[model samples]
Target: MPEKLLFGKYELGKLLGCGAFAKVYHAREINSGKSVAIKVINKSNICNKDGIPDKKIEREVSIMRQLQHPYIVKLHEVLATKTKIYFIMEYVKGGELFNLIANKSRFSEDLSRKCFQQLISAVNYCHLRGVYHRDLKPENILIDENGDIKVSDFGLSATTDQIQSFDGLLHTVCGTPAYVAPEILTIKGYDGAKTDIWSCGIILYIMIAGYFPFYDQNLMLMYKKIYKGEFRCPKWMSPDVKRILSRLLDVNPGTRITIDEIIRDPWFRKGLKFIKFSGEEENKDSLISNSFNAFDLISFSSGLDISGLLKSNNPMDDLERMVVEESPERLIERIEELGKKENFRLRKKKDWGIEMKVQNGKVTMRLDVYRLTEHLVIMEVQKNDGDGDLYKDVWRNKLKPIILGQQIPKIEDSDS
Candidate 1:
């Protein structure tokens, strides 16, 4: 009977949408009069739902907090009461992007390319931050009142923390069937970035052609076609469109065109401005100090932010973080040097660091280098297939010292 005033701040109005575990309502912030979307997640129901991992809910909160792209639905804040968790998000006046396609059979190549540019920019931005939107479909995207694309729904997303011990592959078998990558269906470890690239390609095809490139009434048959990477672009599509589509929908993840390549494509680059958003970059100092603690931030905090309401922060569990003065290139060289001395086989990542494997060919450790500033580089080490004590001993006793410019004796199995 009464309009709900959430936390004595937001005045909740009409219901915008509903899912199995949560319902979104249109709300206005009392102070700023800003129209917002409040997603109320029923704690009791979410706890009982099957196939909905608690991890997924937690990952979405953490990932959304890190992203502030114009083309993404911004999660401004997270709050909780005893019964429900509230996600205060930017309210887009326009509805789902899917509805536009449903109404119009297809978009002109020019319009399709424009939307694809914005979409790719958002996803590419996510990839650079070690976030992979495992579930990307039209329904997950929204169009704002200004008619720009906004990527939504990071519930099934995976971050760097979700990466297996040492390998860079993600094993999660998530995503809608039609848009899912072929490698994902193989049940093998798949590169999240490549899989995302494949989804982007599919979305491009649908926008221009008005239907999925790979489609069949039988689910298994459609998947088989996807696995074989069989799809025919409409004859009306431009040659450039056909060529880029082929590359994007390529079955081999190893050969898929990267985001950078897509950005440079003759078809993709047309009229692309590389637009900057309103709040594109967060503060540099705050980013480093609270990288882990900032997720689901109470804005930005040293510890115990609201993302904690969804899940606990364990920055040291699956990952090792360190700040080094050396450049990413020099750091990789040092890692190569140590790999040689330790008799471990090292695989050089295209632009990152090395993955060190042991005698059995199992990856024991993975090191990724990030340039946070001109002089400050962040190196993250993740365990892949080693014991907890072994990982700590190797990193603390041997690797850390060597990385810090102190020469240490080669690691001995006896240390384990």
Candidate 2:
């Protein structure tokens, strides 16, 4: 027998996540059987004393309803009752992209390129529809089970309606300090599109450098550095990366790299996965009326163990999967090559898995390869036993680029 339904239309499952103001639960659509993540937020945080939804929440819902992109999270509908509001969104099994980066400290060039490409594609689409994501930090970005980007958190977004008629710019000063554009600090006015591009540059830098490009203990000092475009690129970054980042992080918004320029750049165009939009037209009349407002979407946070923005997967939910377009044999062969080059002993296990050992077997690693289709394979990497410099050398230097080229990241989240 099925569990009792919530709202009489959805069957709720395990608690995916929760925070001070909201809880996210896995659920199934009763009629359509579609999987979704339902975020339940307390009405107190999103409504006034009179019980009307906050204007910011309403604007977020309005903006999100208009955005339909593959790389962005899909908000199916909004529901509410006396005490709480429910947000039915696409179910994303994997948590934030911030998790893997936190574990690795940095990403290989290939992986960085893949993430940046997806971000740019989504942001470009948003700008085309006159929407701007004021906050583009790691907390607002998510990854799905398929290892694809799912941009989330539109609470700080703005549309054409918010632009000032007198100056044709946005006067609001909002967003995470580290990612906010330099011009936003002036209090004069700034182009929303340009500020969004600036945030993108900061994100790309963090992916490659494992740190913020502009940061300081003093907020004013940090703002000064950002205003002056004072940042040092890591020496190990490739020439192409450094070159593009220079243009992207330019302090002068007037000269910053535009979306078209980024699309045409050789580095961004490499192995780019061009995701198509749904049948939803860019300028189609909004299908929604004001019948539904929005819940407080900022109650959830980022990090594998993160909580805050509405409801996300549990910080403890550790299942991660990636689909690769390669034969299981080919994938195994590549991993074997990496093991051999790193002077590690490898043994076959169960005809489809490999166990690797280094430093006299003190550090061990295992990979289980499964063929999902004739041409698609999924590999799971598990760590076992101790850790040492030899382990880092094998994993970071020799194995990463070869095994995870433009693939969804493989973060070591288990205790094994």
Candidate 3:
């Protein structure tokens, strides 16, 4: 690695990790002598050849900007050059919660409850600020040296504005498979807060069980079990904990327990003191001012057009097209299997393809499938009454996994 100073301030150190779009590095501020993790995303990777921005990156940055909580990772500053966008963020010394579970297979109930309390507190704080963390899993939850939980990764998060525009509902099906809510797999519009609660319940279960509540080698079967809410708690769990889990993992969002209810529950509240949010009036103004300052700095320094990143525009522009190596007949069969598992109504058209429609309340979506060639298939999805971009996200997060029959292709390898 190059031992050069970045932007004439941050002194680069060791490699942290690399994802499809960015590489994280352990760096230190030369002037302040403070350690921070810098996320360096390639401009070309995230933007189209014509310079159109990626909505996922834009949403992640925007949500992090507005969030200021002890449990959420802090985004200190954003800097950009012609080739890269740099995110200077807090460096949590401890690793992911997944690592902790690997070391100690399962945690005791008291310890699990403590961690769950922190997770719930952080998620509740985000919900209070109108930000919804759609993806909550062990890998995304980081631990600090102090052993406290810090929620990270907002790539799949949605803001309240986006959710409410769709009639107070979100149709985006994005999250880790084992932790995804039943509604998301069903492709039905869902309440973000309630879905997050479901994930928390799964995390709580994993903390005690060291395995997924619903697990299967066959993806379709796993989804079927999830939709049916089929998971048995270990016999050692107390009735109180099991009751709480049932409410959190409810198949119906309407009856799922809310964060407020979870906090108030006697079982969940044991050995935990809720921290009250005080002095909101001043903090709100400060948050707004800081957001503007950050935006101006990025715009002025980068000298790149960021209008698309700052605003919501055409959803069609976000559609993803993939050509997989599979026979058309086999692909169609798999798609049908997945649809049935998720409880979607399928309409097949001979010589053409298939269309699947799913509805919840006033929200509806149509997924269009077409065979471009004998070995290649194309899928396009759109919400009937809301932003089509949300549908695109759902296809990538939820449906794509089933269609690909594996983990979704990474951004770097998808095109090739």
Best by TM-score: 1
Candidate 1: tens digits of C-alpha lDDT, residues 273-295: 55533333433212112122223
Model 1: per-residue Cα lDDT at residue 145:
80
TM-score per model over all chains: 0.73, 0.64, 0.67
How high a TM-score does candidate 2 get?
0.64
lDDT of 1 at 267: 82
Question: Candidate 2 lDDT, tens digit per residue, 1-416?
Answer: 12348878999998876665678889999999988988787778876777555667667765776565668898777776666677788888888878878988998989999989889878987776678999998777888888788898887898866888778899989998999999999978999999999998988999999999999999999988999998998988999999899999988999999988888798988887544323222221221111111221221111211112333323223222456778778888988876776687998764467888876888887776655445666665556555645556656665656666543345686995
Please give the RMSD to the true structure for each candidate, in Å.
7.4, 24.1, 17.9
Clash pairs, model 2 backbone: 299-308, 299-309, 300-308, 300-309, 301-307, 301-308, 304-315
Give the distance in Å from residue 327's predicted Cα in candidate 1 to where it truly belongs: 5.6
Give the C-alpha miss distance for residue 275 in model 1, angstroms.
2.0
lDDT at 26, model 1 = 93
Which residue ranges in model 1 land beyond 4 Å of their true spot? 1-3, 48-53, 277-304, 310-416
C-alpha lDDT score of every prediction, in listed order: 0.78, 0.74, 0.74
lDDT of 3 by residue, 1-416 (tens): 43369889999888888877788899999999999999888788887777777878877876786666668898877777666778888898898899899799988899899899889878876775567899899998989998888998898899865764436688877888889999987655888888899999999999988889998989999999999998999988889989999999999889999877887788987887444333222122112211112222332222232333333453335444455666666777887887676676776642335656644323245554544344555555545454455555657666788768876444576657
